[model samples]
Target: MRPFEFHRPTSLDEALALLARPDARALAGGTTLVDLMKLGVEAPGLVVDIGRLPLAGITLESGSLRIGALARNSAVARDSVVLSQFPALSEALLSGASGQIRNAASMGGNLMQRTRCAYFRSHDWPCNKRVPGSGCPAREGANAHHAVLGTSDHCIAVSPSDVAVALLALDASVAIAGPRGVRHVAIADFYRLPGDTPVIETVVQPGELIVHLDVPATALATRSGYLKLRGRASYEFASASVAAAVKLEGGVVAEVAVAIGGLGTVPWRDRGAERLLIGEALGDAAVDRFCDALLAPARPTPDNRYKLDLARGAVHHMLARSRPC
Candidate 1:
């Protein structure tokens, strides 16, 4: 990695001041940032170490979950309150990275990690996301793992965050602290679609630090699950995955929130699919309609038509398990 100045800050204000420096990046878990810098993909002049800040706690308040951005992935996954109240989220976290990496990875770093696309990883390849207007090589190359939704001609890389999929389904919000002040952003609005500027992946302003993740109380999430389908079993990125939280009352679905991962530029939420399951019983018909509407516009390349079936199966299987039993 290139030699860079590092500043460890004890206070949020101190951290913000360090982050405000031009080309300064935040160092949380150092899982993603360090790798990119070594690959020459990211070259920051200064790294503001926010690992010393008091943002590593996980608490339950007002029946909601408040997860500090600095909270370790393993900590969040193993937290009793999170495991009991938000199984889908816990499962998602547990399924990602390895036990060792999870122990070091932070929630904020997880949320800000860049895409895992091969084109972006290779320095020789032209990628608009890495170099604006350079051109996207994944368009006609090995794009089996590229995004199927919200993909523009400039970029087709998918956001590789299992936690983001779960958060989207649970209606979570991100708390950001910056020079301007603290602000809350809905999880849906936090990630941006790769329209023209694929390089800018998030809505966070420069020098912003993600403080915590705030999730509203939801009965559905308590019984929800996340299903990830990958090429291999133990440690591999998903080819397609589904995160769902559904609440059933009497014999019908009362509430349903669904999001798809591994197949979208951002964590893809299916509001149309959620609406289809609102009053319907959690059965084959409901699943069929939900899958059809959500997967209709998924424009997969020649190498990834199998993802359609995988995504469908994941949704169906998750909902079946999520149904009241």
Candidate 2:
């Protein structure tokens, strides 16, 4: 790791001032940041610790759930209301990392975690995301875990956040504070696809602090679950995952929200699939159609062709299991 100075700011203003500097980065849970630093993927001159700020509480409003950015992953996952109402979010959080990591990983840090692309991590490889215009190694290199959608000629790395996927399905919005003052960004718009600049994973302005995420109140969101298919049962990343939130009224689907993970540069949302089941019964054919629509436009590489079928199976499984909800 490179030598760097650290400052644990007690107030939001102090942290914001430090972050305004060119080479300073916020340090949240440090679960993702520390790993990237060790791999030499990120080397900021100053680590402005924002974990000390008073941004670690969860509030249940009249309708929505307001989650502080610094709220621990375990805290949110274990909340009775979250577990009962937002099972998908709980499942996603429980499916990631480990118990210790879940305890240490904050809500904001998990959303801001870096990609898991090998070429991006290996300094020996030529990656444009690592070094601008250096060229991409994953294009013709080992890419079993790379993205299948929203990829660009410059990069094909996928966002590695299960929680973000769940939040996308829930139609959440993030509150951000920057030099320009506080603003809100829809969670879907918060993450950016790898177009020309793969290095910039999010739409967040520079020096912006993620204050909190607002999970909207919806019957669909309350009846959701996340399903992940990995190589192992624990401590593993998703090979393909599906997040589904469905609300049924009078034995028919009333509303649905679908987002996919482990297969895209950003949390993949399928509006067509969501529409297929919105006003119909979620039968096997409806489920299959939903699955097909979700994977129809998928563009997978030779190394990860199985991800398409894996994603299909995951979608089917999640829908089938969610029926009793």
Candidate 3:
């Protein structure tokens, strides 16, 4: 790791000021940041330790679950309110790393975690996400783990956050604090597609700090669930994962939200495709049509073409499992 100045800020304002510098990076749990620093993928001049800030609270208010950014993944996953009201969110958190990692990974850090694309993590490979305009060897190289749904010529790296997918499905919002003031960004708009500038992955500015996330309490969230499929069971990123919530009325779909991870540059959600299932019974035909519409925009490379099938099956299974009998 590179030599850097460390500052343990005692307040949010102090942390914000420390992070205002372009070459500074925040350390919450250091689960992802420390690994990236060790791999030489990240070398910030200043490491601002924001873990001491008073941003680690999980509360429910006005029918919305407010999760402080510094809340540990394990705490959130095991919270009674989260397990009862937003089980999908809890499940997604548990499906992530291991018990130890979940204990240390913060909610904000999980959202800020970088992609696990081999090319981007390695300096030896020319990756557009790592170095803009350099080239994306994953576009033609070993890309079985790369994305298919939100791929651009510049980058095909998948978004690797399981909790983000669940949050997207639950219609969550992120609160950010910056030099100007605080602002809330909808989960759908939080992530950016890997366009020409793949390095600019999220809407977060250099100086901004994610303060917390808000997930509205809804019937759909109560019925939600998450399913992750990977080569191994634990401590592995998803090859294809689904987070879905469905509400049924009169034996037909009344409300639904679906999001997929490990298959897109961002947590992929298609409200248009979801509209196809409204007012229809979630039968095989309806499920097939929804899946078809959802995956229609996918542009899978030769090596990762199987992800299309995996995602299709995952969507079908998750929707079925979440539907009320």
Candidate 4:
């Protein structure tokens, strides 16, 4: 990693003030940020260590699960309330990285983690996300793992967070703190699509820090499940993954949410497709139609066209598994 000044703040206020600097970056678990720094993709002159901040807590309050930004992934995955109330989130967290990583990775760090695009990670290639207007090689080059949904002419890199997908489906919100004070952003609005600005991936301001995430304790969230399909059995990024929740009322679907990852620049969700399944049973025919509508906007390259089928299968499996026993 490039030589940089590191400051371990003893308080959130100190951390925030340090992070307000233009070239400062917050360090939580050092799982993702450290790797990018070592790759030379990220070079921050000031590293503010927020690990000592009072942000690591997990609690159920007012019918929502509040997860502190610094809470470890393994702790959240194994929390009894999370396991019972938001099993999809637990499953999603467990499916990511390895046990050691889960122990070290923080909730906010995972959400803020960059895409795993090879071109962006490597200093040898020109990537739009790394350096805007330099051009995106993945658009016409080796892009078998690139995104099918939310792709623009500038970038096709897929989102790599499994828990973000699950949280999107669960209707979560993130609390961000800055000079303007704390603000809540819905999961749907947290991640930005790679339209004309592939370099800007999220709504978090430069000086802001994610404080916590709140997942509403709704019937749909409680009935959710996640399914991930990858090239390997372990320690692999997903090729296609689905997180789905369905609330059945008298044998008919009452409420539903479906979000997909590894197939989009951000966690993908189609409310129109969800509407099609709102009043119907999750039968194969209805599920097929839902999947069809959900994948209708996909623009997969020839190399990654298989992701469409893989995403469809993942949706089917997740929805089926999410249904009441």
Candidate 5:
């Protein structure tokens, strides 16, 4: 890794001041940023340590779930309140990295995690996301894990956050603090598609630091689960994963939310599928239609075309498992 000045700030104001400098990056848990630096994918001149700041609380005020950015992934997954209120979120966290990693990775660091695309990581490859205008070799290269939805000609790398998929299904929002001020951005709008400018990944500004995550409680949260299909049972990223939350009233669907990861450029949420399942019985026809709603617009590459079928079965199975019959 390149040599860089490290500054540990105790207060938010002091951290923001350090981040104001050019090529200055915030270091929360050092889970993702540190790896990228070692790979030479990212190199910042100044690293502002935000781990000492008091932002590691997990609160459930009224009905909403409030998670501090510094909260560890394992703590959130093992929290009794989170397990009872948002099982899908807990499941997604556990489905990801090993227990050791979960103990060290922070919620904010997970949000800022980069894609696991092979081309993007290898400095030898011509990846548009790694180096703008270099051209994306993944568009025609070995793309067995590339995205099928929300992809642009410039890039097709999939988003690699398992917990973020569950968060999106819960309609979560993030509280961001920057030089301008503090503002809450909905999770749906946080990620940007790999458009012509694949370099710009998210809505987060240069100096903005994610302070907290806001997940509003709903009946859907009580009846939810996450399913991940990977090459192995553990310590592997999902080839196609589904986070499903469904609420049924009198054997009929009342509310539903579903999001898929490892199948899109971002944590993919299909409101159309949610709308189609509302007020309808969970029958084969309804389930088929729901799958169609989610996978109709998918345009997969030749190598990863099986992801379409895997996603369909994952959606069907996740909803079936979430049923409180």
Candidate 6:
């Protein structure tokens, strides 16, 4: 890793001040940031250590589950409130990484982590996400793991975050702390689609820090589950996954929220699927329509077209898990 100045700030104000510097980055868990530095993919002049800035807590407050950004992934997964109230989210956290990495990875850092696409990590290949206008080689070469939805000619890298899939299903909001003050952005609006400039992955400004994740309580939140399908049984990234929450009334689906990962540029959410499920039972006909609407926008390449079938199976499987026995 390149030698860089590091400042451990005790206060949020001080941390923000340090982050205001040119080419400065925040060090939360050091899981993702440190790896990028060693790969020469990222070289920040200064790293503002916000690990001690008083932002690590998980609470179920006022009909919502509020989680501090610095909360450890393992801690959140094991928290009583999280396990009871947002089990899908807990499952998502536990399913990602190994036990050791989860112990060190922070919640905010999970979202801030870059794509796992090999081209973006290696300096030899040209990637628009890493270097704007360099050309996206993954589009035509070695794209077995590339994205299908919200993908453009510039980039097709997926945001590898299982927690993000769960959060999107729960309709969570992210609280960002900036120079102007704090602003709450819906999880749907937080991640940016790779339209032309793939370099900008999020709506967060350079100096902005993600402070908290606020998830509202709903009937669906209590009855939700996460299913991840990977190459191996353990410690592997999902090839296809589903985070689903549903509310059933009189044996009919009242509401359903679903988001898929590992197949889209961002955590994929399809309101059309939810609309098709409402007021109807998840029978063969309804499920067929749900799958059709869910994968309607998917533009899979030749190598990764299998994800369409995998994603469909995941969605159907997770939705079944949510049904009360």
Per TM-score, the best of the predicted structures is 3
Cα TM-score of candidate 5: 0.97
Window of ten residues with lowest summed lDDT in model 4: 316-325
Please give the RMSD of candidate 6 to the true structure: 1.0
The lDDT-based order of candidates, best leading, equals: 3, 4, 6, 5, 1, 2
Per-candidate local distance difference test: 0.89, 0.87, 0.93, 0.93, 0.90, 0.91
lDDT of 5 at 154: 95
Candidate 3 has a TM-score of 0.98
Query: How displaced is residue 152 in candidate 1, in Å?
Result: 0.4
lDDT of 1 by residue, 1-325 (tens): 7889988999999888888777999999999999999899999999988998999999999978999999999999999988888988898998898999999999999999999998998898999988999999898999888888888989999889999999999999999999889999999999999898999899887778899999886777787788898888776778898888777788888888889999999999879768988889989988999899998878888987788888889988888875666
Give one digit per residue, the lDDT tens place, for model 5 in 1-325. 8899999998998888888887998888788889889999989999999999999999999879999999999999999989998999999999999999999999998998999899998899988988999999988999999899999989999999999999999999999999889999999999999889888888888778899999988877878889999999979888999988887888888888999999999999989777999889888789899889888878898999999999889988887874666
Instruction: Please give the RMSD of candidate 2 to the true structure.
Output: 1.5
Over 211-235, each residue of candidate 3 has an lDDT whose tens digit, in order, gives: 9999999988999999999999989
Candidate with more favorable, higher TM-score: 2 or 3: 3
Model 4, 194-280: lDDT tens per residue? 898999999988779999999999877778898999999799999999898888888778889999999999999999989999888
Error of 5 at 306 (Å): 0.7
161-245 per-residue lDDT for model 2 (tens digits): 9999999999999999888888999999999887788888887666789999899877787789999999999998888988887
- Which is superior by lDDT, 1 or 2? 1
Model 6 segments more than 4 A misplaced:
322-325
Summarize candidate 6's per-residue lDDT along 52-85 as a digit string, tens digits: 9889988887999999999999999999988888
Which of 2 and 6 is ahead in TM-score? 6
lDDT of 1: 0.89
Give the least accurate 10-residue stretch of model 6, judged by summed lDDT: 316-325
Overall local distance difference test of candidate 4: 0.93
- Score every model by TM-score: 0.97, 0.96, 0.98, 0.98, 0.97, 0.98
Q: Which pairs of residues have clashing backbones in candidate 2?
A: none
Off by over 4 Å in 4: 322-325
Q: Which prediction has more favorable lDDT, 2 or 3?
A: 3
